[model samples]
Target: MTAMPTRGAGERLWIGTFLVLGSLTAFGPLAIDLYLPAMPDLARVLGTSDSLAQLTISTCLVGLAVGQLVAGPLSDRVGRRWPLLIGVILFTITSVLCALSTSIWVLLVLRLLQGLCGAAGVVIARAIVRDMFEGHRTAKAFSHLMLITGVAPIVAPLLGGQILRFTDWRGLFVGLGAISVLILLGCVLVLRETHPPHLRQRGGAAGTFLSLRGLLADPVFRGYLIIGGLQSASLFTYISMSSFVLRQEYGVSPQGFSLVFAVNAVGLVLGSQVNGALVSRFGPERLLTVQLVMMCVAAAGVVGAALADAGLVVLLVPLWIVMVGMGGMGANTTALALIPYGHAAGSASALIGTSQFLVGAAVAPLASLVGTDSRVMGATIALATVLSLVALWRVHHARRTTPAHSEPLTTTT
Candidate 1:
């Protein structure tokens, strides 16, 4: 765990780094969602209400948000490898705990441990990518990562649905436990420590906390994280409420609802591909602005439809548009946030990732109050879009002293 001598990201390391890190990044989402279909069954088995069962999910997210802040800085000190190994072990143990839990409380606590370990994959992967690539290359690498990681959401739920038919809910956790083992094997064999000893600060926790202070103090950094967070909320809000709105309110079968969800995944893939192209040409600022505008317009349309009592098509169209905008904005804004901190990529990625998910967790509860009307989806999208526009303006305004046309993100992480 002692810091090793620092080394640059050599060309030979590029392909290995990209593939290893991308797979590592896929660990968390796949673990979380692959078991989600078992939630209702889990609730019944544990003798808990649906609301209490769902709180287990929120607790996992809470663990992710808080754990990443600690993990990022620790990675800076002890190096990326050990924290990652330890996290993998913890996650594996937690998955077993989840599978064996006799009560809802035990399951919820184990879920939090799973979230804690999740910080390793998401935070460290971003840091490693930032360590090696700068500007356009960094963005492109992330695009590739998203392309692979995107498959989790597209496929995990369906896989979960299938698994549920054949096995008990405990099997869901067992499957996830196997995924943890594979993730650890990948890391042990494929991922080398990218944070060289010399490149790290020696200030320990104080040094780490100060690095965070510096990032938070920067208006441009805060702006990018806030904007990215809002975009996440846009997507998660739908996820939080989708079943109730589509199945209960609209009288659709769960199978039918899953089909509709599958249709939206295509939009995400298309947007990620478009983002890699658009960012290089128009730059992150202009691209984010365009998407932010599109999102607001989409939100307005959906909201209007909801208020006017229009049909599902009215809602579906705007929802797709919103998804497309989210696909565009998430990567671009993350690039912007990390652009300034290539040297401290771990901390930067942690801040952005935590901000994005925490904001999402904070807003997603609105679904409980809204009662599955189209207004639930419409209102969530509108609010997230509004945050995006505001954050975009703040980023622009913070850069006013420099030339607006000058691309600050071109050379750095």
Candidate 2:
């Protein structure tokens, strides 16, 4: 069932396929990160309160989470290519509308639309990979896609800041629109219909619901989902609070913080590439076990560093290891979670994406409610990784205890 490299022969075609899929994976990150530097400017231009301006981000996050639930199932129903093409085209149009927005309310609506449309790329790209590859090869493909998602956070803000120096917030939206247009071209050029008519699901809404319920009932799949969701919870907590913690607690300059952020991102990238190289040798299950344990230890160290009022270097060292663990675990968990659901890869991918965001969104503010300080951030991250480890243990235990014949199976139409 593996996909041949798209539209041509040899090594170059494979590279092109990877690039297009990687670009698809970048949609959510690009939409969120690319305009972050312009938040204050956006607030001022629209004559809105800072809190209201912040709502734009929240709205977009909501859109991303909800949109996947729709787009993923839709892709399964109709086949992958047209949903993706239409979604990207609509996303581009929405980005243009966002750029033209003069009111906060209007901009918020447009951002939400952008997230909904852009979500097609995020979910369907993973679905397409699952449609093509299996086992360790699936893990490898995901790791490469993760390279783009991992790099986006690092590059987008810096690039956005530079864009701000040249033009206003509206210009940033225009830039986003341009980026999507390029992705749209890539989609049209490289992507083929991986989910064909014979393989496509029928029964419409009822089928989608049944597919989701069946996936949820499988303990192995559910465990992987929980593992991924909690890992993302830890990562997002760091993302939400790290700048403030580093600046306020350690007296780091903005430039110093950016350097530290980039360093951590590079660690993440390194871990992902390494995981891809090792998965074939070590296996995703074994690799996942080791990575989660490492993350648990490193996350606990972050709590210790925060409590002891340690040096900045001490705190950062553990954080970097956690980032690395996150990088490795993401592809592994996703690859494993999706292995059993090729018939519903879109739905499975959608659940994975949605759960990560929903769980992160839920947990991040709880940490904030406690405090935005280093101690709270560290504890939240530690708690998340520990929970992830527990979920992994539970998964293994269930597998060992449950009879093979009784294990739940995903029903494919």
Which window of ten consecutive residues has the lowest lDDT sum in model 1?
A: 3-12
Q: In lDDT terms, how accurate is model 2?
A: 0.87
lDDT of each: 0.77, 0.87
Question: Please, what's the RMSD in Å of model 2?
Answer: 3.7
Give per-residue CA lDDT, model 2, range 1-413, as digits (tens).
Answer: 33344211231226767888988888877889998998988999899999999998888888898999999999999999889999999999999899999899998998898889988999999998888776667787788877888998889888899999999999999999999999999888778888877778999999999999988987878999999999888888999999889898788999999999999999898889999888878888888989989988998888899899888899999999998988989999999888778889999999999999889888998889989888999899888888888898888877877674234221111
lDDT of 2 at 237: 93
Best TM-score goes to which candidate? 2
TM-score of 1: 0.91
Clashing pairs in 1: 4-197, 5-197, 6-196, 6-197, 6-198, 339-413
Highest lDDT: which candidate? 2
